[model samples]
Target chain A: LAKTTQPISMDSYEGQEVNITCSHNNIATNDYITWYQQFPSQGPRFIIQGYKTKVTNEVASLFIPADRKSSTLSLPRVSLSDTAVYYCLVVTNNQGGKLIFGQGTELSVKP
Target chain B: DTAVSQTPKYLVTQMGNDKSIKCEQNLGHDTMYWYKQDSKKFLKIMFSYNNKELIINETVPNRFSPKSPDKAHLNLHINSLELGDSAVYFCASSQGTVVTTIYFGEGSWLTVV
Candidate 1:
């Protein structure tokens, strides 16, 4: 299992872009970095995933550098509703899809 | 149509009681998992099953037992629940064991009084 480290909390205003970064120094070769967002009273939903370089989706974009030791989740033009806990996970294929979630970054998008 | 679903969205039980939360996924996924989110909102993986076989079992208490009767269903049973057991439990499934996208069901909130 790969452990991740992220900020405890962040504050942003509407219309601003928010970028949360996670560090997984001991990431394995077969590990992929995935991000999930969780709102109050709801389950976590996938945001974006990437192995190297960058991957973009309708909701967010993931940026992984050449080192692959860390990844960043970028939310463009944030809104108050974007306030949620964002988790960065490093999952291995041999783990049977088991996700180890750390203390996610609590993103607060203020009006 | 709710690809993944769990029964008893909310459960309230007294300490020392036993309860179970049932989950089923219609996405034809071969792997299922149980994750617990504590009050402070720290999420942790408790158990995982793939093709009706136990694959990952974290250091969760023995009182918390997960049963997979088939590929589509995975149920969690907690015996002698404690106050600390109060948290939201989530059921999730992925297509296979190759680190594909995982879908999550609307969580099951368990409150132990």
Candidate 2:
């Protein structure tokens, strides 16, 4: 599994765009980038995933550059409810492979 | 409907006691997993089962035993629990053993005193 690095924390105001970047320099070709959001005292929720280019969903958007070594999770018009810890994971189509989570970026959305 | 659910949302027990946490997924997924989140907020996989077969067993303590009676149910039983065992345990399931996104439950908080 490829190790990932991301910011420890970020601060954003409501109605602002928040971008969290993750670096996976050793990302393999078959690896897919996935982002998950975790609130305090709750399970982590899948936000968006992408192999390459940009993938957008109702909740968030994931941008993967050509090299695939890094990706960015974009949350549009953040709210206080969006304050949570975001994790970036690199995985493949393998069974039983662990989802190695790094110290996720804590985004605090202020009102 | 609850896709994944766990019983005993909060468990408070004395040290050296045995306890069990039950989990069931209504998503009809073939793979179920148990994860432990420590005080530092680090999430680690403890066990994974596919179709009632043990697939991934991390380097967890032998006291932690996971049993899956069927594809939709996975239960975790801890023997001789210690204070360090206090943490949030999450149950998750995926469509298959492959790299599909796993859906998680609300998690069970275990407090060993």
Candidate 3:
């Protein structure tokens, strides 16, 4: 079975901060929580990845609590173009790090 | 300036046909992968190769074969295709044997009618 779970969909308006959470109860020690955004007719694009605490890149922020059971992807002041399917995956470090993808959360950014 | 690229962006073929999708990465990554996204929007890993050697093989059918000629390329060849084989095929690459935030190509849409 796949190792991650996320909401099916979310709605956000322009200029609003959007946060999508994913649960991975059995995440391994070497596993990294990574998020990817995919637009129609395109492949998944890497957004943000984190191992612990909080990691922020220019595009998004990743927050992982102490338990490592869940993580949240935060998009600041989202726009309509930010609307896309966001996938949460757990990537292990051993044996070339297997990445298992789940049914991503469809984020709808309203005007 | 594309990092990863795949050929035959779209393909339409009848069942039992043999087709192939070629992928190349210029990012000098040592690991590459093939991922399939079905109509239901479920994305799954099909195969993984490191330095032109097969490493990870999912439970995909034998008809779906992956060929990595070198560190820079991994090609997918499907034999005896079925209607269930239609989906978006994505080629991805990473820098090392341990998976990092990999890079993906635009994807090749293969339709088996």
Q: What is the C-alpha lDDT of each candidate?
A: 0.91, 0.92, 0.91
The best-first sequence of candidates by lDDT reads 2, 1, 3
Kindly provide the TM-score of model 1 when superposed on the true structure, using C-alpha atoms.
0.94
Q: Considering summed lDDT, which 10 consecutive residues are worst modelled in model 3 chain A?
A: A92-101
Which runs in model 1 stand beyond 4 Å of their true positions? none
Q: Candidate 3, residues A52-79: lDDT per residue as tens digits?
A: 9999999999999999999999999999
Candidate 3 B-chain TM-score: 0.97
**Candidates' TM-scores?**
0.94, 0.98, 0.96
Error in Å for residue A9 of model 3:
0.6
Model 3, docking class: medium
Better of 1 and 3 by TM-score: 3
What's the distance in Å from true for residue B17, model 3?
0.8
What residue pairs clash in candidate 1, if any at all? none
Clashing pairs for model 3 are: none
